[model samples]
Target: MNIFEFIRDPSQIGPWFHQLLLSAGMQEWVANLIGDVIGVLLIVGAVLTSAIFLIWLERKIAARLQDRVGPNRAGPYGLLQTLADIVKLLTKEDVTPDGADRVSFNLAPALMVMQIIMVAAIIPISAGLIGANLSVGLLYFIAMSGIASIGALMAGWASNNKYALLGGFRVVAQLLSYEIPLAFSLLAAVIWTGTMATNNLAMQQGELLFGFIPGWNILVMPFAALIFFIATLAEGERAPFDLLEAESEIVAGPNIEYSGLKFAWFYLQFFVNSLLLACIFTTVFLGGWQGPFVDQFPLLGIVYFFVKSLLVLLALMWVRATYPRLRIDQMMTFCWKVLVPVTLVVVLIVAIGARITPDRSINAVIISGANIVALLVTLGIIGRSLRRDVQRRKAALPGRSTAQV
Candidate 1:
């Protein structure tokens, strides 16, 4: 089937395995079981496909940003580069350090891979297309995301390398620092919509304010949206917040001992989290699977969802190209001292605004205004604090002026 047909009728589009099972006149239960297995396989295939595309895209974007040519060989603009890398990794040796804990070292990568795959289950491509629709879907997604931190720690401890162990500790600190603001920012959105189900959140974003402007939660809570995106940047270990594996400083950090496929697993998890971040951002803030005429042609939702997600993904790539990595101290300080307090105030503002206001449209706008105000206020306070610190330090230095210092 073509892309249009597949988008319009996902269940009807077959990979032949499920089709063969159904065509054999299998019982309903058996057919469903086989189909589900195929669905999982298909999802895995999709992740691999996306990884291949995104890997190439990242290098191209980075090259462009750095003013150089990217891959022009290997099948038209280096589309086959990722494929070649995969083959190389799969064919290479798998080495284990003698001091490494064999069981934990082997199991850590698999555990992280499992958690990454689990996230795909709740990512909605369209209204009717999802692996499962739990009532607490958003909550579940948040909880499951943190489990991979354990795998990170395990990878570090199991390696018996000092750098790996420090990397593991850094992962724990980074995850804990970011996850709090991420959760509260999400709560601010939930406070406005009053549901933890991702689908319901999507539905809430479906309305339009002036018939053309989308009623996206981002419009109502831009601060939360910004905070959520930043937190996810840290969570995904992207640039600027990716101190966990600062090559110059730590020599590859937690995965230093992992060779071949095990290292590939670590690499895969980064892009997976990136993809999932874009999807969740679409669902919560960009109106998931929502666009013009989607009501009339519901299948168009898949197109809309992908388009939105790609735009977000591109923005992330741009950020990676533009920003330099933060100091570990700065990364943690920004999360705890800035994001946490700001998100808490935003949540409180949302809660109060929702309670006193009768109309959702009016309340949403008011809450948005309040969030912006709070953001500005927080920035002002931070600026003042930084200036004060600078002044005190300059005073302590007898020979240094502020500019010279």
Candidate 2:
């Protein structure tokens, strides 16, 4: 069967979706394999395509913001930059470290890509666009995505590089720290949405927050959304939180020893990981494919979802360009000291507000207001502390003596 037939039928019988194909007796195995293979291709294709577009979009947005011309030479608006890069990468020689563990080193990138593609299969783009709407959809995503760290560690260890090993260690440490806030945010959603299922969470967004506004989780628990976004960026190893791959400090981090298509796989995984990040953000906070306009138009849901995801992706890229990465100490401190406390409070407030207020509007107002107050207070404290430190430093310095010299 072709792509269209495979997608339309949904009776394919691979291990991924075989349980659903129990009724198809004769062709079950063949059909399922076809289905699974197709599913994998579609997901991988989507990742690569998204990566290409995202690269172009990031450049365009950053260029506009920085008052410079971005990619416009390669194809129209330089849309094929990623594709070109892919071709170049593909033609390059694959290199393996002489001391590297060949088996694990080769397996690592494939494992990384596989894990990402597996998770992508679960994110339903449209009503019938899901691979399998498993009951434990959100749980599946968290659990499956967590496996990437193992791949990272394997890549680090297999390569026999100190920096790669350190990068892997840092990634694991960072992910562990940030995952708490991420889980807490998801928990807040589960409380508000009342279901762990992806579809249910999407449906919740259709419910009105007050009376007219669509009831996105963001409106209900804005703080959780903020925390989740930041934590996810850290989890995804994006900038400001990307101490794992800090180029200045650690060359190329975990994938430094990888070359050619193996390296390409790592890059591809990052892009796909970005897409997954966007989807999770949409599902958890922005309401998945559910939206006021999309409810009527149906097809508009895809547009809405993609647009929101793209905007978010661009924001991350912008952050990557604008912000210098934090020191490892600062990265850890920020997660443990700042994000953990904030998200814990957000979760607590969400629980209390959910108990007291029947109306989502009032609860949203209360929760969002509380979050804003906390943010402002934190900022004020940080500002004062920094000012005091600066003044003390100036006082201690040999100011006049140094100036004369």
- Using TM-score as the measure, the top candidate is 1
Clash totals, every prediction: 0, 3
TM-score of each: 0.93, 0.86
Model 1: CA > 4 A from native: 1-28, 210-212, 401-404
lDDT (Cα, tens digit) per residue for candidate 1, span 1-405: 467766555634544446667779997679888778877987878875687788888889888988988987888988898999999999999999998999999999998888778888777787757776678888887888778899999999999999999998999899988999989988888887788887778877888865667889889889889999998898888889889899988888799999999999988888877888899989988889878887766787889999999888888888888899999999988988898888888889989988776777788778888888988888899999999989888989979767876
lDDT of 2 by residue, 253-365 (tens): 89999988899889878877877887888877887877656654556567677778777777777777788788999889878887787777777777777767777678777
Stretches of candidate 2 off by over 4 Å are 1-37, 395-405
In model 1, where is the ten-residue run with the lowest total lDDT? 8-17
Q: Of the candidates shown, which would achieve the greatest lDDT relative to the real structure? A: 1
C-alpha lDDT score of every prediction, in listed order: 0.85, 0.78
Measured over all alpha carbons after superposition, the RMSD of each candidate to the real structure, in angstroms, is: 2.8, 4.4
Candidate 2 lDDT at 4 equals 58
